[model samples]
Target: MNTIVQASPVTEKSRQLVTVATPENAQYLTFLLGGEMFAVGILHVKEIIEFGNLTEIPMMPAFIRGVINLRGAVVPVIDLAARFAGEPSQPGKRTCIVIVEVQDGDLSHDVGIMVDAVSEVLEIPANEIEPPPSFGARIRADFIQGMGKVAGRFVILLNIHRVLSVDEIATLAGVATPGEGVAHRSGS
Candidate 1:
């Protein structure tokens, strides 16, 4: 006698994928300033360009180097060293401009920070960063985002927004607008 065996049908159910919050991992573009290493979050950085001619505006703050024409858009360049209250950095062969976007309210401006040299981009785990110290920092405490520990070295991560506060700079410099058609050039 032959027996027929029946097999059960297999059913597939749709599964929904869910995402969970994870630790933040940030990347920074490192650069040298005054023989020390500094960094800024890569997201804020637009591009790195060769140091070029800048149209100097008169009566501007000492840290405000000048403005450069970037693809027809004027970009103000800041002397990072000078901004830190140190002597201005003399441009060298490796000198380059790091373009960063700073936002104010609903408007964003492209500002260039002059660095002695551009270093490598590093991926630093968020946990490895330490909060900015309350005192003894060469630059203002607000200017530092955190101190990133990298290979036993501390990299000063700059809070670009604080360092390049558009409103504050304009008010302090008494300039109309940085990178805005070279305003305030009459009173040198």
Candidate 2:
């Protein structure tokens, strides 16, 4: 969680420079959350695992559902719904955790994000991607990569790095960790 990310790296396959209708393609892994379709760059995805037990840490932010031990490493699991300041998500039959590697500083940390269900990997043309709107989005504008047009519909492209920023989340961890001298901030 102490990792630092300068920026999200684009995969070699998606390294093509995109301009207006240039045919340059990028792949995104699509998923459902709160009845809306959202996607993250495929390059960031590690693997998908079934939702299971998580060790809840006390006094952390509500969005931080808990931590899970993945092959001896302590990986934190985040509720994307709550992270967006929405209601907590209830894991359903199709619910699962998507393991993603987030670059922080020079190191990469594995983090888990809960999604209602994973849809599919889609190759979208760069021309079909529109810059994030300045307002009226359910989540923070900084969290959006773009709005992608697929099959005449719009899918929110998530800027996972921004959404899972280690520095920001680390602050929350500090607030919860004993001896940090920061009281937990809560609001109804």
Candidate 1 clashing pairs, residues 3+ apart or interchain = none
Candidate 1 error regions (>4 Å): 1-23, 177-188
Please, what is the whole-model Cα lDDT of each candidate in the order they appear? 0.81, 0.81
RMSD of 1: 17.9
Q: Which stretches of candidate 2 lie over 4 Å from their true place?
A: 1-23, 175-188
Looking at candidate 1, what is the lDDT of residue 159? 96
Residue clash pairs of candidate 2: 3-104, 4-104, 4-105, 5-104, 5-105
Cα lDDT of model 1 by residue, 1-188, tens digit: 22221211232210100112234757788899998999988778777777867778767778999888777677889999999976788999999888899998789999999999988877789989999999998899999999999999999999999999998888778756645654444554
Name the candidate that leads on TM-score: 1
Q: After superposition, how far is residue 118 of candidate 1 from its true place, in Å?
A: 0.6
